[model samples]
Target: MARQRVPEGPPPAPAVQKVSVRYAKRGRLRFSSTRDFQRALERAVRRAGVPMAFSAGFHPHPRISYANAAPTGAASEAEYFQLQLTQQCDLDALRAALDESLPQDMAVLRVVEAAPGALADLLQASVWQLDFEGVTLETITDAVATFMDRAELLVTRMTKSGVREFDVRQAVLASDVVLVRAGDADGRDLVRWTMTIQHTTPAVRPIDVMTGLTELTGLQVPRSPLMTRLAQGILEAGGRVSDPFDA
Candidate 1:
């Protein structure tokens, strides 16, 4: 064989653009594991033909990062992730493309150019809505009073690392019980408990609130409450929450 020459190709472009996207997991998909959601999102990115960036190595992965993923089996209106792109993209068009590619319930809610600061740091707290049936406002009100009054409402949680104990009340910024409805023929009234809580070391969950209520006032929920995260962002000193994108 004779020596031959080959043409060189253009150099790969750099990943200079960064974007942040907020999405929601609702209905049956709320039960989807974090890994499951990650796979789905990866597939959606491919389907949408997004100019995503990859790591520079023998085995490269997309430069997509998730922040504060809602626990499996919980629904959320605000979930966020960051994506690195090889080329600039219109935020609105990117949002539309992702919304069209993803499942209806798991659609993207908003997309914004990545700001200067870290996205995770901006999200310091969450506002959660916990729905309960067959629970009266009187019971919840009394429990709330006791929970807020206590200096430390300690609770135990078993994590992957190990069993840890923390005070759930300290993480609770503010809480209130709202009456969703009076009652129906069955005598089950719809009620919702909403609270703004900080993201502490061992984060406090809605179930933890239920646990604290039962521990403090002996009040019980007939069934598992529907846990939904309404919003998440920087919880200000004045108790107002600002969206991460705004910052």
Candidate 2:
């Protein structure tokens, strides 16, 4: 086959300014996958009339970079991404426009001039909160105790590459159980499991931690336990997650 001629034209304008955004995925929007958010964001960017930079190739794409997206079916307060723009704009106004353009449940929380580093490199850990209904606080506490005591807890998850196993314990830095509500009128108990986990390859998710708990102590996790990412950033010396935007 003969070599195809490359499309000829002046290259697209280089990015003039880059801004990092922090958004929230809450309520029913949490069920939407990463690709869904990407599509929605691209549309929102157009609707908001932001001057986005594009690639030089024939099929030029928006210069947006996503970092450490939260898993599907989990709500998050600290989802982050960066956008390269062809022109500089007021961060506050851009944030408001984008927030209004997005769906009701997904809201833009913060927009700041990106610092001198990759956003992904700053996100070293995540703090997650898992709320379990129909389970006693004592049961979850015991399970967490058992999970923390073990030196290693291997769990399996089915991926596109088939069954994969990894030690969830190694990624877990700290964990605790709290009683959200004690014996409500419907006789249902709500328990919250808060944990700080280090970001690692094949990232350990809240479901994996629950699976490890079940495996270690025969704890029954609720089928629809609500999982929310409270924060994601650099892991500090005292096991706290520092804001990446503040870096």
Candidate 3:
């Protein structure tokens, strides 16, 4: 009997270094779910030729972790994730490769070496922009004032577990109605609002804030406002959100 030849084994994975990256979800891609983005990222990694590490087991997956994913249907400019690489490489080059591999709407914004602490911990609050049509700025301003003055404003939302109630007032650190234009060129009613909310249990969403506004002043916003996450980071002493990469 002829001796059987030895089978070839898989190459060993290299030691990984953690890198934190900031990306944006603009346009229709903002509607993509976290799982959807993850799949896209995995494909981009392969196309970018990133030397990513893998787990040990029957099935190995790329060692990647995400932090503070925005809700679906919400456009965001400050989404973030941590990627593990098999070896140290030029971050700028990696970012460029990945950006080119991804779609136009889902673009990479910044890449930096991660610090010692957890990435999630760096994201303590978020700043959101809500633009409304068919609503007067005065009405929106009054509603915000009322919501801020109140000690407690409870809002209910239907979660997967069941119905839940939380204090929308406590979650909101600060809010104001901004006037992008005194009036539209068409002279239509419009209101631009910005708010900062802390991360808490049963996170308060933009819809919940709208509900609170309606409950407070009985001013019904006819249509859903365009919601966008302007930034997510640690809320500083003066209501400013500090970027995680700066830390």
Candidate 4:
């Protein structure tokens, strides 16, 4: 077959600078998938008049890199991405504009000049909060104890590849249960399970840990527990997750 003729125009402008951004997914917007955020961000960039660098191709796309997006149906206070710009711009201004352009629930929390290292490398762990309604603190505490006592706790999740099982216990660094509210109008107490988990292959999600707890102690986790990623960054010596931007 004859090769297609090349276009006559010059290539797209190269990126002169890169900026790392931390954003939040809150409220109902937590259900938005990663692709949904990508589309929203592209529109927001254009709306904000960002000088985004584009790849040289028939179908040019903005130079944007996303890392460690929270799963669908999970809210997050610390989500991160990077943007390559055709020219330098004031980070504060860029952040304000982008935040204003995006939906109110999807707020741009922080914007920093890109450092020398990979952002992914700094994101070594995550702190998650899972809130369950109608669950007692005692019940959750017992379940957590049972979970931690085990050498390994395997759980299954259906991925694009297929249903797969992995040890959820291995990724867990620390865990605790707390009572958030004594009782609601329905006379159900609110309990929260907070955990610090190391990032691992085929990442063990909060749901997986819930499954492990359920399997071990027959603890009934709410069908749609309020799952939120409180923080994500380097795992510190004391099982703390430090800010990636600071690293």
Q: Rank the candidates by TM-score, best first.
A: 4, 2, 1, 3
Q: Which has the higher TM-score value, candidate number 3 or candidate number 4?
A: 4
Error of 1 at 82 (Å): 0.5
lDDT string, candidate 1, 130-240, tens digits? 888897888777888888888788889999789999899888888888899887788988888898989988888877877886888888779888899999999988666
Clashing pairs in 4: none
How well is each residue in 146-247 modelled by candidate 4, as lDDT tens digits? Answer: 889999998888988899999999899999888999988988999888999999989888888878878888876555689999999999999999999998
- TM-score for each prediction? 0.92, 0.95, 0.91, 0.96
Clashes of each: 0, 0, 0, 0
What range of 10 consecutive residues in model 4 has the weakest lDDT sum?
A: 216-225
Local error of candidate 2 at 38, Å? 0.3
- Misplaced by over 4 Å in model 1 are 1-12
Candidate 2 structure quality by residue, lDDT tens digits, 1-247: 9998776898888899999999999999999999999999999999999999998767999999999999999999999999999999999999999999999999999999999979999999999998989889888888888889999999999977889999999999998889989989988899998999999878888889878888788876556689999999999998899999888
- lDDT per residue as tens, model 3, 49-137: 99998876556799899998999989999999998888998989989999999988998999999899899999999999998887678
Question: In lDDT terms, how accurate is model 4?
Answer: 0.92
* lDDT computed for candidate 1: 0.87
lDDT of 3: 0.88
Give me candidate 1's TM-score against the actual structure: 0.92
Model 3, stretches more than 4 Å misplaced?
1-12
Which scores higher on lDDT, 2 or 3? 2
Question: How far is 165's C-alpha from truth in model 3 (Å)?
Answer: 1.3
